[model samples]
Target: MAFSVLTINPGSTSTKLARFEGEGCVWQDVLRHTAEELAPFGTVSEQLDFRLGLVRSALAAHDGGAVRLDAVVGRGGIIDPLPGGTYRVDPVLVDRLRLGRPWDHPSNLGGVLAFSLADPLGIPAFIVDPVCVDEMAPEAKVTGLPELPKPSLLHALNVKAMVRRAAHDLGKTWNELNCVVVHLGGGVSVVAHRGGRAVDVNSANEWGPFSLDRAGGLPVGEFVRLCFSGRYSEGDIRRKLTSGGGLRAYIGTNDMLEVNRRIQAGDDEAAFYCRAMIWQIAKEVGAQAVSVGGPIDAVILTGGIAHDAGFVRLLLERVQWIAPCLVYPGEDELLALAQGALRVLRGEEPAQDYASSVLRQ
Candidate 1:
């Protein structure tokens, strides 16, 4: 019998959960908690507990619904940088995740939630293709020696989903295509999927290019000046770079939908920013395509911004010359995580002993 699996992804402001029964996606749910409401937690752990309660209540309400689920998979958390594989997360993994010492994104905490809930119920849990997709080349790792840089390929889940769905729709296997995948969300990331695997990506950490929230890779002297401003600490600068930096910083709102609404209503400022953001995406995506030597099968755009018709049209017009473009506007992380766990549960996939969690190409 095909296994039943539940997957969870906790974003900064929302918790996304889904269940997959066999090859079909049975059901999915997303529950959001506003950051303002969660401010009292002071730290991530307290916030995690508060959100876990909300999820527990949601699961309880759904317990009587359509079908019984067999296993639960939270977003994978910190497990030394190992190769891509699914494992039944044990106590060791849970301890490491709770500490959030080495790696701690809210998404990583999904693995913790999955482990806590799955183990007690005697079900299996796993984090599939975590940020630890670190197969970085030696050069990618060394950031002037002092930093020993390790930045996550955040949004790999959605990017991979784009690759999978695009391949499925294009009548080609993923391994047959070399594509540049762009995930435009509250923040953004562009990845180079080479030889059917995501060889390199830039999202939260290091600089890529200018983004909605991030300064991207800025000039050293100006960047140093900006960070040295007495008004902001390192964490403050990072928050701006990660969350507060993007469109919100520019226009005071992160809602692309609202921005587009303004554009339609004849707000020239909104239209200008929209063009600028897409242009940035187009420029970076084109560069990634160039890195792969100009043979791009499709420029795949996924995530919330990808759902915007005006933005997609703008981006396509700008970058379509690279190749045809495809839009996979939905995120399929729950399905992706569930499938990985089901493979482990059914004995069809082996739990790879990932040597280096970060696959630095």
Candidate 2:
């Protein structure tokens, strides 16, 4: 039987809704929220009812109460670190999301919203590989400072999805291959996939290559001096490093298309910065290759920036010798969410229990 599933991915200003039957997406919509609309909510978690109403309305209009959903899957949020897989949205998980542990993010609404819609129907609600999926090897987590260990927060949803796709293309199962998968979007994640496990990865938000908006790795001594300078607040420095750095800091914009246009128009500085970012990405790929060890079956380039042929070509020139380079441009996170639920619903993989998963940690 083809399981029908509803997938919800909540971003900062939009809620992406999609319904899938088996492997195919029946329809999809992005419910964009304006600043004024979200202004009333004191916190992201408080906007649950507001976002839920929008999703409910969208589903009503699209499905017209005709389709019976087998399951509902949501984009996982920033919760405790757990391994990668589809997790059942139980009370424990919902409580964590509602509490917004660590910090509050718009994504925290995904699971709660999914549960709201699925609970009445007596169907299962699931959250796919969230940002907190930590599968780093113990040795990989260590740093010179024992207190400041590395984190395994990457684009796991897309990374795992692309890994499965790459495995299929290579006529191998996901567990049968060792690959280095690079997700190049707003942040860059260079991950070493040994068999099916993400043994090591640079936390996109904190390390790895400088991306469209993130600073990536910075000189430790200089960063410390800047922090002690007291010219900027903690929040200011964090925003600058994560949202105001990289190509935007160098070229005044984060849009790669704009950078490409400027380069074509004979902007040497733009071209130089672009090349530098690509070089950093290639270098990170080499570092991850060492983490994977042995022979890497393939090197996959994915996410939005992979659509840039010139950029991919430059990156390939540097890393292609390591293995055959494959480009899967753009991320389909909604589909990835649905596929996670389908894998469990179809008995291909067991659905992880959020409470037990956390306890095991």
Candidate 3:
């Protein structure tokens, strides 16, 4: 029997949801939250019930008319470092997300939202390849300074999904291939997947390439100086590093389409900055190839930014020598989530326990 599942992927201002029967998506749509609708919630966790209400209303409007869901899955968020797989949601996981300490991301609500629906219905809920899926080799975690070790936060769901897709296209299993998967979206994360394990990755939340909005990796001494400069508060510095930095910092806007338009319309400075971002991304890909050790099988680019032909062409020019460059534009996180639950339902993979030995501090 095919299992019906609800997949939830929450973003800052929008929730991407889909209803799937096994691997087939029956219904899908994005639920956008207006600023006024989200203003009351001071914290992302606080918006839980409000977001859940919206998800339910969307499902209710489905043409199937109150579809019976056997399971629910969501995009994972900041929790303790764990292996990449499907995890069964329990109070331990829900409590961790509610506390919101490990890291606060909109995706954190994914697990919360899944549980809210699955609990009373007496069905299983799962989170797949969460952002905190840490498979880093010990050397990758060393940051030279003992106090600041690198964190393995990446778009694991999409990256892994695309990697497997690419492997299938190449007539090989994902475990038999080695590739560098780059996820370029609002935040960018490049990961080295060796033998189906993500041995190392740059966290988009902390640092990597300066993406459309994120500052990425910053000069430490100058960053520290700026933090102590007293011209900004903690929130201001955090906002600057996260939401207000990168291309937005250089050109006063984060929309790459607008930047590309200006460049086409004879804006030299805009062209320069956009090219610079692509250069930085290429440099990051090269760095990860080193981490994975030489002779990358293929360099795959997947995510929203990969859709830009000009950007991809420039990036390929820089990194194509290292390996074949393939583009799998856009993310399939909603399907990735549902498939995680489907694997367990089909007994293809076992659902891991949240409080098991797999967790590492």
* Best model number under lDDT: 2
**Which parts of model 2 have CA positions greater than 4 angstroms off?**
359-361
Tens-digit lDDT track of model 2 for 19-132: 999989999999999999999999989999999889988989998977899999988999988999999998888999999877798888899999988999999999998988
Residue-level lDDT of model 1, residues 199-283, one tens digit each, is: 5566544567555556566577877798887878898987877667656677777777778778889988877876777777788
Residue 302 of model 1 has an lDDT of 87
- Decreasing lDDT order of the candidates: 2, 3, 1
TM-score of candidate 2 on Cα atoms, chains taken together: 0.98
Regions of candidate 3 where Cα sits further than 4 Å from its true position: 63-66
How well is each residue in 27-52 modelled by candidate 3, as lDDT tens digits? 89999999999999988999998999
* Ordering by TM-score: 2, 3, 1
Model 2 residue 171 lDDT score: 96
Q: Candidate 1 — which residues are off by over 4 angstroms?
A: 31-42, 46-57, 65-69, 78-82, 102-104, 137-152, 229-231, 346-348, 353-361
Please report the candidate that would top TM-score against the real structure. Answer: 2
Predicted structure 1: lDDT = 0.71
Is candidate 1 or 3 superior in lDDT? 3
